[model samples]
Target: MSDNPGPDSDPVRLTAWVHGRVQGVGFRWWTRARALELGLVGSATNHADGRVLIVAEGRRADCDNLLALLDRGRSPGHVDTVVAQWGPARGDLTGFVER
Candidate 1:
């Protein structure tokens, strides 16, 4: 992949739909920590539909690494699935927040 980050290239944005025993489990906190460690900015929140939605922005590699970590269930809970994608990055997010 081209390492060059074009002006139009927003940071790498990843929206993950994490499932399986994710609620009430500090999953958001764990994700926030990881995102920070990876120098990413975003937020993670629990959905009423019993799933967690994590939106993160950072370098492409960092985004991929975060997804890998999630897929490996490095967090406190189990991650049944991690649906991720790459898109135009955005402005510097104000830290990782829980919504």
Candidate 2:
């Protein structure tokens, strides 16, 4: 198998800040499950300011799917807004974690 991603298989990093009613509500666990399902690797960490930071590295399409899911209003907590930043994937993460 090739190490390089094909044209449509470009990898990316998705960093999303999820706001509102997300702390202590199994949000990170939910995100970890979804990320793993999508074959992504990263973490969903709780911020001191009551936000959940979700970072996932995988194919752009899979990452986008996860982002869409986050915005679809069906998560464990009520999500007010999701602020996202995208960049090239950094192959430094292992399995997804809830931190």
Candidate 3:
């Protein structure tokens, strides 16, 4: 089987800064689990400034779905806003991890 994707399959990378009640509220854990379920690869890190930085790489639509989840945030962690940047996938990540 070819590892290469077909022309119709557009991969993407999403760098998102999640704000509001994200720190120590299971945000990273939820992100890691959800990302893996979506067959994504990347990492989620907690910033000292009370923000969660998530880098997700996957199919364009999957990445978008992940972002939507972040927008709603999770229970116990009310998400105020999600600042995201999207681009072509780099294919450098192996699996989703929380940091």
Candidate 4:
């Protein structure tokens, strides 16, 4: 089989819990923008314990790009750490949402 992934190959779900000064700094909005740009469908939600949860589903490369961006600390607020989990895509989310 070819090594390269086709148009819809390598779909996955990225569950990333972002820690640090993320809430109240337009972080979710920024995440939504980035996810939309990457053509990923998911939601960025704020937890009561000062953590931002990001769930993105799309091509593996695209999800990887988002994770890299989160780790680069170029977002709205300072990102101390990014805990990520990967799995098969559920294909339920529509557009990216900031919650």
Candidate 5:
């Protein structure tokens, strides 16, 4: 196996809006934990409209996994819908944080 992914492979950034019952429910904390576990770096915060805005940068597959996890919900909240916006990874974030 090679040590690098190759020229065609690149890090990915996700701007996801997790909607429905996501505020004031420790979802940000849970999201941070999950992102850290996936070795991703970015931030998660709650909007005043009851949606969680999560910006995560990492491997595409890992971000996908995180999306799947987010869609299924964790606890104290129900994830009704997930709006995903994918793009080139910024690679600027340090660690998972709450913003």
Candidate 6:
């Protein structure tokens, strides 16, 4: 990963799994909206084990903000336990899509 942030900065890849009462609510939509607002590129999907998987690519600060937002803006009866990993940076995604 490069240390410098530039105009052509590559998008940082992040894969996060949100646990707890994340499903059955609008968590996925909420995530997608936030990602779009932050100009992030990736997808958010619901796992079979009552967890939500999110793969987002964006700037370091934007990614960090997403994590914080997820933690803070959880829906009622929503509890999220997230685990994230950084991957190779990529290009800007077209839009946030639910899958």
Residue-level lDDT tens digits of model 1 in 9-76: 35668888988888888888888999999998999999998889999988877888889988896787
- Cα shift from native, residue 98, model 2 (Å): 0.9
Query: What would the per-residue lDDT of candidate 3 be over residues 1-52, giving only the tens digit for each residue?
Result: 9998774378889999988998787888989988999999999999999988
The window of 10 residues in a row where model 1 has the poorest summed lDDT is: 4-13
Show model 5 residue runs off by greater than 4 Å. Answer: 1-9
lDDT comparing candidate 3 with the true structure: 0.88
Which structure among the candidates has the greatest lDDT? 4
Off by over 4 Å in 6: 1-8
**Error of model 1, residue 20, in angstroms:** 0.9
Comparing 4 and 6 by lDDT, which wins? Answer: 4
The true-versus-predicted C-alpha distance at residue 35 of model 3, in Å, is 0.6
How far residue 70's Cα lies from its native spot in candidate 5, in Å, is 0.4
> CA lDDT of each candidate?
0.85, 0.92, 0.88, 0.94, 0.89, 0.80
What is candidate 6's local distance difference test score? 0.80
Query: Which residues of candidate 2, in runs, are more than 4 Å off?
Result: 1-6
TM-scores across all candidates? 0.85, 0.92, 0.88, 0.92, 0.89, 0.82
Worst 10 residues of 5 by lDDT: 71-80
* lDDT of candidate 4 at residue 78, scale 0 to 100: 98
Superposed model 4: Cα runs more than 4 Å off: 1-8
Candidate 1 lDDT score relative to the true structure: 0.85
**Residue by residue across 1-99, what tens digits does model 2's lDDT show?**
998768558779999999999988888889899999999999999989999999999999899999999989999989999999999988999999888
Q: Write the per-residue lDDT of candidate 6 for residues 30-69, one digit (tens) a residue.
A: 8999989998988889889998998888887798788788
Give a tens-digit lDDT track for model 5, residues 1-99.
999878436898999999899888888999999999999999998888889999999888899989999997664589999999999997788989997
What TM-score number comes out for model 2?
Answer: 0.92
